[model samples]
Target: MKPEAHYNTGPNELYLDVRLLQNLSGTAKWGKVLAVLGFILSGFILVFGLFMQQMLQSPGRAERVADVGLSGFTIVVYAFVALVYFFPSLYLYNFASGMQQGVQERSRQKVGKAIGKLRVLFKFLVIMLLLFLVLFAISLVMLGTGLSDFSLQ
Candidate 1:
């Protein structure tokens, strides 16, 4: 049997450029800082939401129940907004950490994991943007119809 020819695969191995690594490292640090801030903001929003709910339930505030109810709705909205801000921050932080580790260790797997997290972050943002666009379009349509009705009266 003929011996198999040895093929050189070393040149095909992926290597991150020095400049790219430097850029990624800087970005990772910034992402970590932003993630920490996002967590703090989310915590505050949660606390404020709970406080609003508690105030609404207090006995002496019965006369302002309607206003309190509006506040309750506002709390829910804020909580959702906080969550929306939070999840992306978490993904961004993870990506940053992973990328930093990958660079330090020169591990392709770690870098791939970091890229995955970044992909998730981008996907979430895109979905949110699409949702907002749809809602804006619906609101515009509603406003136009209402205006038309008013003009006919």
Candidate 2:
């Protein structure tokens, strides 16, 4: 069969342009950065919680494991952080799929298209930032109160 026919026909005759693909790549880049940031922040929070729990439970001991309170905090922090990671990852996947569609539609791209893409990417990034800030604030409040099903101490 024909190569073009195989790659761009029947079940896969997706139509897209270079400008659109560039925009998608820009958005995907933002998504990747956000995903990485969320993962890193989550890791940091988990480690911090572990350390704090160790300190709280171990005045003289040296073993390091989270206490019940800190463990609860870690779980909550991780859950939200996981969510932070999930959205960007989902966006990235959608963006990449869309970009592939654009590629099949148009064989070439340009700088202007890339720049236009950057605009939406930045907007999405800002939204993610706002989300992070709000969640972080909530986490801080929870931490201040201490994570517990019931206060034993």
Instruction: State residue 35's C-alpha deviation in candidate 1, in Å.
Output: 1.5
Worst 10 residues of 1 by lDDT: 4-13
lDDT digits (tens) for residues 31-65 of candidate 1: 88988888898888888888876777678775687
User: Tens digit of lDDT per residue, candidate 2, span 1-153?
Assistant: 776654453433333456865765666566557656655766676666566545656654333434334535655665666556555444444544445444545423432343345455567779989987999999988887785534756
Clashing pairs in 2: 23-117
Error of 1 at 85 (Å): 1.2
Model 2 misplaced regions, further than 4 Å: 1-9, 60-153
Clashes (N, CA, C under 3 Å) per candidate: 0, 1
User: Superposing all C-alpha atoms, what RMSD in Å does each candidate have to the true structure?
Assistant: 5.5, 10.6
For model 1 the TM-score comes to 0.77
